[model samples]
Target: MTRVLLIGALLAAVFWVFSIVDCALQPPIRHRGVSKPVWIIIVVVFPVVGGILWFAVGRARASALAARRAPDDDPEFLDRLGSTSDQDERIRRLEEELALLDAEDDDPRWRRPVPPPAASQSTAPGDPADKPADRPGDGDDDARDQRGAAGA
Candidate 1:
């Protein structure tokens, strides 16, 4: 009898620790009843009772296998199960599009759009509009240009 009581006390302590850890790990949004902090306090203060309450009221229910309702309660899961026909239609449409693209590829004359030839105004090596010939000694030209602009 004394051994059984000791084992029971040990089990209760283990259960209390497990419940407290699980409750602490659960995010506030996932907690159902009171709040995560309150649940933790409850579990710490009362071991067996708090663990039972946590399982009963504090844990969040999974959408796929939540506690009680009719089979049709989850319409999204039902829709997923019923999507074979929609998937077949989608695959057919994609195959048709691929065939059209392959036909276009087979014809050498049906080529992708080409950009128009670049204008010749810029003689610089890189992109003409982006970089200019200005360098270390270019400040003289800029000062002259600014002076000219101010005068104008």
Candidate 2:
């Protein structure tokens, strides 16, 4: 009976230590409008009862609060799921069907010949006008031009 009592005491001490450390690491529970520090004091001052109370009530409340604050779903996770190859295949098939339906509709702009670049432009002849402008002084021209304009 004495040995059993000693073992029980040792087990209780271990449980108390575990509970205290776990509670300290976690954000404190707010129970019935009482703050976490009060709960921590109660647990530390009255180990067995405090530890049991924390496990039963405090931890649950804190967990619930954290869950409520957490974001609903991960954007990257949803993106990966939504953009899977199966979805891409479905989109491709729909686009092909649309193309077939629109084949009879002639839009001249889609088949029009591209205009040639101006002679003064040193860019490749086939390049579009919207392509980046080629300039001899691309690196320092803007600053020099600004200073020149200011001086004038």
Candidate 3:
């Protein structure tokens, strides 16, 4: 008999804890008669009785829970969304932009041209013509050669 009483008390305590957690976790709108905090207080203060009351009276009905909807899923909210014409206009603008891009791809003027080097610029460093000693009118040896050519 004492063991039976202890087991019953243990079950009640577990039920009380479960009820308090359930009540506290519930959203305010899901509470039936009173606010969520009040429900939590009721469950906390009365322990086993509070937990039973919370499950029986305070919790929202299954139908009410089932009736809740997210904003995107709600019919009234979807109806308030802008008309198809606005979406069509935006799509048309996007198509126009894509057409412009396609036209640019086919147009010669839109192509980037690789420019030829200017005549005044020297060749790359490894070339004999690019060496300072080989270049005309550059250093003392070139000036001497020019004077010798003039004298000849």
Candidate 4:
């Protein structure tokens, strides 16, 4: 009886140490009602009863709650979701097309011809009529020439 009690006491001490260490190391498993420190204190103080209570009620419940809340950790589920390679391939194709268009547009031979200056347009900046009209799409062919003259 004495030996049995001593062994049980030793086992309880070992279990208590393990429970405390586990509680310290693991991120506190959150649940709806009870907080983590309360559970830790219960486990640490009560030893065998606390450890049993924690494993049976608190720990199991917390783990089940976490599993239900977040299922993305499952590798099989992720595998079934399909790869992003197709998206990458589509983006690459678009980038290649853009590059081709840029190369074609940048080539001097494919460039649009610059329009010749209008006959009535004066290149002088000081001319009252040469002041740029605010109206949109007004034929102001000499604007660039006047700016160039002013800069020089």
Which candidate has the highest lDDT of all?
3
The CA lDDT at 142 in model 2 is 42
Order candidates by TM-score, high to low.
Answer: 3, 4, 1, 2
Model 4 RMSD to the real structure?
A: 11.0
- List candidate 3 segments past 4 Å from native: 66-152
TM-score for each model: 0.42, 0.40, 0.44, 0.43
lDDT of 1 by residue, 22-51 (tens): 999977877986988999999888889999
Query: Looking at candidate 2, what is the lDDT of residue 129?
Result: 53
Question: For candidate 4, what is the total of clashing residue pairs?
Answer: 0
Q: What is the Å distance of residue 25 in model 2 from its true position?
A: 0.8
lDDT of 3 by residue, 107-133 (tens): 778889979887886678787566665
Number of the predicted model whose TM-score against the real structure is largest: 3
Separate clash counts for every candidate: 0, 0, 0, 0
lDDT of 4 at 21: 71
For model 2, state the Cα shift of residue 15 in Å.
Answer: 0.9
Please, what is the whole-model Cα lDDT of each candidate in the order they appear? 0.78, 0.70, 0.82, 0.69
lDDT of 3: 0.82
Compare candidates 1 and 2 on lDDT and give the better one: 1
